[model samples]
Target: MRVLIVGGSGYLGQFLLKYLLERPEDEVIAVGYTYADENAGPIDHPLTKIDRCRAFRVDAATGEGMDACVRAMAPLDLVVNCAAMSSPGKCEKEAELAMNLNVPTHLCRTLLEHNQKSEAIAPLLVHLSTDQVYDGESPNSVEDVNAPSPVNTYGRSKLNAELHIAENYVAGRHVSLRSSIITGSQPPLRPVSRPLFHDFIVNSLKGDEAVTFFEDEYRCPIAAVDIVAHIVALSKLAGKDAKTDWLMRYNMGGPDRLSRVDMARQTAEVLGVSDANVEAVSSASVDRGVISPADISMLSNKLNSLTLVSPMGWKDQMRLALGMAKM
Candidate 1:
């Protein structure tokens, strides 16, 4: 199988590349813009050292290096889009960049043209969306039934990307995973740019100063590995024998609805650390430069029904993330 993972240098992208490459039959191609740090010159991405995968430095937003990438790896079996300017503050500040990076229109058009030229089946595009598309007024939001009412630029950009895929790829050759907060360890062979939520909680509990977490904000955080698993399952269903009329959008989230404070408490309990310094606060009190939704918890009934895989609860997810349990 030939796979193309856009934004392959990012956190979840690296995880997908590492997991998919475990299969000897798979040929993985990773493309991203930030392979090297701006201050560090042309340092190589650690994942580039992997023998089975080919890595390319391409900016999906500007369409630079895309044609060359498509020409090099045509007739792809699957294309997983993990590209996005995910930070809400950054998205709000740079709306244009957010839209360009979040939306996969350029990537889709390039792939569509190549597929048309080669006369091959369009590869399944497993795009990574966010649960922020919800209005936050409700919990366990269902796909399609609840109309998306985004409260921020990040969510709006993500929603637009989903719309593009749904309208353009009408044959059900695409899967838009509206994923919640993805928490896990850093990707192997990659530089840790920032601490993940799980790490932030753990580090705070182990430190001297009090750390504040939003108790009112709620999300169904899924382990990174589980998201990769969903993509793999969807990839297996691709091709002519696959179901063409199946649902295109799926809510990919963990089974439990938890807040940041709830996660911190659970992490402390699981890791046998003291939570005395863990502070619980409301989201309304914080001025994060972006409007954060109160409750974006989502139900993954559709994803579970399709993949036949049940997501782990918060505690187990914490354990897996902290390296207490096997992946």
Candidate 2:
């Protein structure tokens, strides 16, 4: 199978790329972008250095170089979209940028044009969405049962992106995964400076400065490897099944519903680190510049039924992420 991973430079995207490349039967193309910097050239991610993977640099926000990317890799079997400006505070401050990057309008248009020209089945689009689409009032929210009520700009942008894919790609070749907070370490091949929730807790415990965790905010944090596995399983399924009439949307998350404080305490216990600097605070006490949902825990019954892969527990997820457990 031939696959295209947009935002392949991201944390989750890198994991997908690494795992997919291991199959040896699939050809993987990674498309990543970098901000313009006079002082430095584009980022030289270690994954791009691998000879087996074909890498491209494109600005998904502006659609620059996207047409060339699609044209170069014609008749793509699958396209996993992980591109997004995911920071909630940044999304709230720069609403337009968030809308442009998160919406996937340009990416979908390019793919549609490609599909119109090609005779092969349209490449299945596995888009990574967020669980923030829920209003936090409900827990273990089901995809079809609960109505999406995004309160912040980040959630709104992602919800709009899902709508666009559903409207345009009605042929059921597209899937929207409303994923919760993805918790794991950076990909081995591609190290990241930005820390994830697990990394933040570990760093705070190892350092002298205090780190405050929200006791009110709740999320079912799925491991990065689990997310990658789901995408890979879907890609394999798409290869076998040619049916393109059923629209797919799944709530992708772990089984545990944990608050930030809960996660921090767990991390401390798992890694045998001190939680002395880990401060527990309510979301109401913090002014993060965006309205945070109190509880967006999701039930992944649909995803499990489809992929046949159960979500990992938070403790095992932490071990896998920290390289303490086998993959």
Candidate 3:
């Protein structure tokens, strides 16, 4: 299978790219904007990158660099979009650019148009969305609901993108995955990337003994590796009579209900930091932040009904995360 990722350079995209490459029969093509000029070579890495995978910085906004990027690739079996101007502050600051680059509302429309006109295989579109949409899922809401409160401009824009993909695109050709914040390995020159858990471990390990975490904020989390693997699995199911998710939205939380404080404490445990070293502070105490929802839980996996697979403990992944971070 030939796979393409929109934001192949991002934290989640990096994981998606890595997961696909592990399969000997798969070919992964990673497309994104390269901020650093130095590492923008042919993108052939040893472990994480297979020879079949190619990563390039293609600016989907303004349509610059997209033609060549798309033209060079083979007809794709799957196209996973992980690209976004993901930062709320960044999206709010440049709303228009955010719409173009971050939201990709227009860009996705263009891709569908291109798909209709071109000879390339109409690939399954797996758009990675966010749980921030629910603004912590207001009272009486169930896990299957796709409607969101969208607390920030970023969340609103992401919701907009999700709607566009669902309403305007070809049916049976797309899926929207709404997951909580991701935590994982941060690649070099990729400061925009930070794992929610690993960052705390790093902070704790660095002798910043007293680490501050948001007290009121809540979120569901899945490992970046798991996210990519799920996406890859979805990619393999393209055009098959696979079971559709509820209303095109999925809740992708880890097994545990975690707050910013819970994540911090867990990181402290992984790093062997004492409980006293982790502090639960209010969002207002932060230098820069948002008055976010008290909780935004997501449970995307339909494991019990479909495969009967139990959700794995998040702590094990947390341990791997800290170990990898230290290496």
Highest lDDT against the true fold, candidate: 1
Provide the lDDT at 208 for model 2: 76
Q: Is candidate 1 or candidate 2 better by TM-score?
A: 1
Candidate 2 regions with alpha-carbon error over 4 angstroms: 25-47, 207-210, 244-247, 273-277
Q: Summarize candidate 3's per-residue lDDT along 1-327 as a digit string, tens digits.
A: 656677776677666665655656543444332222345454442322545555555665676556555555546567788887777777777788777765556445656667777745567778877776787655323455545878877788778888888788767677777776676555432444444556655566567457677777766666676676566565655544454453465566567677777776776676665667667888777645544556676554562233233444456667656564332
Across 103-184, the per-residue lDDT of candidate 1 in tens digits comes to 9878888888898898778888889999999989998899968878999999999999999998876377998999999888
Root mean square deviation (Cα) for candidate 3 = 4.1
Error of 1 at 145 (Å): 2.2
TM-score of 1: 0.94
At residue 264, what lDDT does model 1 achieve?
Answer: 94
Name every residue pair that clashes in candidate 1.
none
Model 1 misplacement above 4 A: 25-43
- What C-alpha lDDT, on a 0 to 100 scale, does residue 149 get in candidate 3? 77
TM-score of 3: 0.81
Better of 1 and 3 by lDDT: 1
152-226, model 2: which lDDT tens digit per residue? 999999999999998987366889999998877676565654677777677788987888998988899898889
For model 2, the run of ten residues with the poorest summed lDDT = 32-41
* Deviation of model 3 at 179, angstroms: 1.6
